[model samples]
Target: MAGTFYRVQCADCENEQVVFGKASTTVSCAVCGTTLARPTGGNASIEHEIVETVESR
Candidate 1:
């Protein structure tokens, strides 16, 4: 199976970052300490708007 990546923009700071779709841990914004995604049983739950889909290897 292929892993999915997402380019998400932080709502608080508008910081953009790439995150794994099936992340096992919480993801936060680099610029600001805002929560971006949370680990779920399946794909991660995104807290911010997704800007684009990123290709991962």
Candidate 2:
């Protein structure tokens, strides 16, 4: 089984950090020294796909 992970960004330093471990936990950023909110489950991958929709008026 794979460990859980989360995507968190620093509020002060504007840094992106990823936490890989257990669920319902918190992780800290290594760069700006800030704590971030981690997800409940899944891999440590933060990459997400964006879908854009255009509507004609």
Candidate 3:
């Protein structure tokens, strides 16, 4: 399966992970052995930009 790299911190375990693509639905924290949050797929990248319009009175 295709996957991507992610860096996340465990809520219960408070451990940081550098997941490399195709992460499991439930991953155990290596430090405190806590369940981590997993992606539900269908996620897309988001970008934002601002445009300014000037008017003279």
Candidate 4:
């Protein structure tokens, strides 16, 4: 199954970026290099603030 995308804001820099819900690798913030999400078998463990949930159209 396909996973959704999330618009996440970094806690340290407030930089907004897209992250995969089912990411297999660690996802980091673009501007601050902060940990945004991590792999957790299924849905990623999001650490930053999730501003929006993107649905595939």
Best model number under lDDT: 1
Greater lDDT among 3 and 4 belongs to: 4
Cα lDDT tens digits for candidate 2, 2-52? 454445556666676555544355455678655554454652233232122
Q: Is candidate 1 or 2 superior in TM-score?
A: 1
lDDT of 1 by residue, 1-57 (tens): 778999999999888999999988999899988999999989999989999998876
Ranked by lDDT from best down, the candidates are 1, 4, 3, 2
Instruction: Compare candidates 2 and 3 on TM-score and give the better one.
Output: 3
Q: Highest TM-score, which number?
A: 4
TM-score versus the correct structure, for each prediction: 0.90, 0.42, 0.45, 0.91
Off by over 4 Å in 1: none
Per residue, candidate 4 scores C-alpha lDDT tens digits across 1-57 of 777998999989889999989999999888878899999999899998999987753
Candidate lDDT (C-alpha), each: 0.92, 0.46, 0.47, 0.90
Please give the distance, in angstroms, between residue 18's alpha carbon in candidate 2 and its true position after superposition. Answer: 1.0
lDDT of 3: 0.47
Model 1: weakest 10-residue lDDT segment is: 48-57
Candidate 3, residue 6: lDDT: 54
